[model samples]
Target: MAGTIQRHPVSPVSALRLFFVAGWRSNLALFRWMRPSAFIPTLIGVPALQLIFFVHLGRYLDTQPVSYYALGNALHACAMAGLFAPAMSLAGERFAGTLPALLATPANRTLMFAGRTVTAVLVGCSSTVVMLILGSVLTDFRLPAEGIVPISAAILVTAASCSAFGLLVGAAGLRTREAILLGNLVLYLMLLVCGINIPRESLPDGLRLIGEIMPMTHGIAAARQAFTGSGPVTGLLLVELGKGLSFLVLAVLTLRFLERGSRRAASLDEV
Candidate 1:
């Protein structure tokens, strides 16, 4: 009794505040170890390097490689980051022994989970802006003045959609320890099938069919349209937003289901 640690019940208001704070701190912790040199290389440099590679490679084959790669890769970075961050958060919470408490809290699960995911969505959006700025600087390409509004809107939708999908992945992650691996797998799958480097039509028929259901497929097209000042196809943006909503609904249901099972098994603390 003397050595026992006292644990106080967290008030709903306090839990909500901590929920948002945890999201911010978790995202910050992700980059804390990486000094600018290392962090920049991964976050900004890799995409810039990829842009350069495509620019040079396109020189031999085409006159407008920047047009092809700049927007695509920028959007790719944003989509992937948004898509994985929440999932990684779930895995981290599990490993840290905080997930069960968070999930089991009397607080509204939807509000709590959404609060925790906001930073990741913002990270995704900021990454998109950074990649676009970097790509423009490193190449002849530039963001069109007229396209700015449309592009910004498209970026927001892409980030939102990917964040929802990531939340779904996080919910599923409650059942397994491999959430991070699942996140990476989804990221690469999107890269290949979402037309990041190649046209979606160029994909094999089977993969193309699969790509249609992927989170960022329509969002990427909207991104390209935004770059051209053609206006984001409203249908595409709607589809992306719809997909995100559907994923969020699915995540909520999955989390509820898993919670039921965990309660029966009395294994909420199990990682």
Candidate 2:
């Protein structure tokens, strides 16, 4: 029994089972690790920047809307946080050979993915709430007492969307360092094009149209309308909710396709 153990290659279903076990355990590790790394920045730096940019230096800018930027910044932090947290963690696992071992196990892929996605959502929301409380305490931002609920929904939805996309990118580009770079670059472009820092109306007509398609476009606008408005929350809720789910579904499908292809080509453990 001790002689060189010939490992029976795992079937697709067995591999998926292993993946779920590893993914969940990995997610818990992520939960513990990301607190100081990702959460701290989302809690302090990003939200403080929002307060500083709007409250301190916002008036001097040309027609820059503070109320709009507040919630925009919040969405920005959620997006950035999702990108920074789960993707980086996945990359680390890939480097450590955890992913191939995971795929070789017997866990369900859907359960595996759900655990990772849920981790991203929960962590993203926790950090977002800290940002919200910071905004309320440090700035003139006025939100509905019940506003926390919708904002949280938006944050979790957005985080799931981003994390799913990250998983796709991470899996597909495991060999290249471009995954993180590309994600952050896309995030930066989204920040600019999505009318977060500046109104879409201020952009050229063609650019304005492009901005509308970005997830950040709908996410930021919807979040802003909810954060500083005395009006109905239904519209913003619908926009963020619907669009966020769409992005998440698309991203998950991308992950599913990419994972199958990736496994067909090579396992994560192979050089």
Candidate 3:
């Protein structure tokens, strides 16, 4: 009994505190490398410019209403934070030579990585709001007073879903240096297929199927419906929520699998 070590379960409060602290630190580390000048442009300016460009393009083509492009691109902008942030944060640990130390800790691995998504979702929502405001000011985009709550909820869900998918990209980064590249690839794929600029009906069946299973499709649809007060939004929102949960599960499983493999091979920090 003299050598016996008693293991105590982590209290709920302690777990909550750990989740909060991990999320806060993860967000800080995410932008620590950038100067304010670069950071501001990357976060706000790039997305704003993107929205402006596409809105004008849509106007030139004379295909859809300005609100269509505005809402679509604004939702798409969520990925700038939702996808890139988590991938960079997780993969950055390897780049910074800290993954080994992080893995050596006694904390819950899932909680630690998952907490990082909180800030990502917050930043994503902020990005969405900024895009919406810009759309309203620069174009004919308008949200009815009653439509605000549903649209806001749809944005939050979409960001969470995108962050979940980003975690999967981050998990892959555990072993490779191409995580950012992969994130960019997925982002563009979503842009092309997920009804951001072009309507889903315009896409080929194969691409439409791909978009159906992806994150932003349903959320974008739900938000659009909410804005117009046309169709039932609850169904779309539920499907979006389901997509997020699926990605979240896959990310956690992929992370755990990679973590085990890396630990077994003594390659946790090899990137």
Candidate 4:
């Protein structure tokens, strides 16, 4: 046994702690929106302004009730936190010159990256709540007492789903510098196709199909139904959860694949 070392496996509780600690540190390091100057405008001011714009636009068009736009845009605002934050978190490691060090660690790649989603989901849910409150105060948006629980659940699920999708974009950032650009592209694409501003029924068949498979569509529908207390929300929530899981799987796989390729090619530090 001379000169040999034995390593004990980490306990479950310790593993959990490591997961959270790594995630928190990753968020602190990579997610710049945590700063007051960035946080205020990104999470609060931007979403609030977006809600106001859409609410007034809907009023001018006189197409749908104010609640419709309010709920839709509020749900969409969650993406600002859920999507952009996580994408930046992973992609930023490369830009910060930490990717090589990160890869050199003995941590579980999946858990480390997935843990980043925890803060993203929390921030996203906060953004959703803020948008909802602004909608209620500034517009005719109202959530029935019975609908509150379901709407809250929908918001949480939708935020998680958006965070998962963001991880996928971050995975791509391992290979290229366009992760943030891709995140913006997907965000606006969802805005148009995910029934945020316009009805999916009005979109062409191709765009409608795209929206169907995307993250926010079902969550937005579930929230709207919850807002009105018109129908059962279980199905929509389940579908939204499924979509999140799918994106999470894809992101993990993509991260692993890229990590291996970079190691083989000695390119982890290349950018």
Cα lDDT of candidate 4 equals 0.89
Supply the global lDDT for candidate 1. Answer: 0.75
**What lDDT is reached at residue 27 by model 2?**
64
Off by over 4 Å in 1: 1-22, 25-42, 58-60, 63-65, 230-232
Q: For model 4, state the Cα shift of residue 54 in Å.
A: 0.7
TM-scores of the candidates in the order shown: 0.83, 0.75, 0.94, 0.95
Poorest lDDT segment (10 consecutive residues) of candidate 2: 1-10
Cα lDDT, model 3, residue 240: 93
Flag clash pairs in model 2.
Answer: 14-105, 16-107, 17-106, 17-107, 17-108, 18-105, 18-106, 18-107
What's the candidate order when arranged by decreasing TM-score? 4, 3, 1, 2
Could you tell me the lDDT of residue 62 within candidate 4?
91
Whole-structure CA lDDT of model 2: 0.62
Q: Which residues of candidate 3, in runs, are more than 4 Å off? A: 1-8, 33-35
* Inter-residue clash pairs, candidate 4: none
Q: Tens digit of lDDT per residue, candidate 4, span 135-227?
A: 999976788999999999999999999999999988988888899999999999998999999999999999999999888999999999988
Q: Which ten residues in a row have the lowest lDDT in candidate 3?
A: 1-10
Model 2, C-alpha of 263: deviation from truth (Å): 3.9
**Best-first order by lDDT:** 4, 3, 1, 2
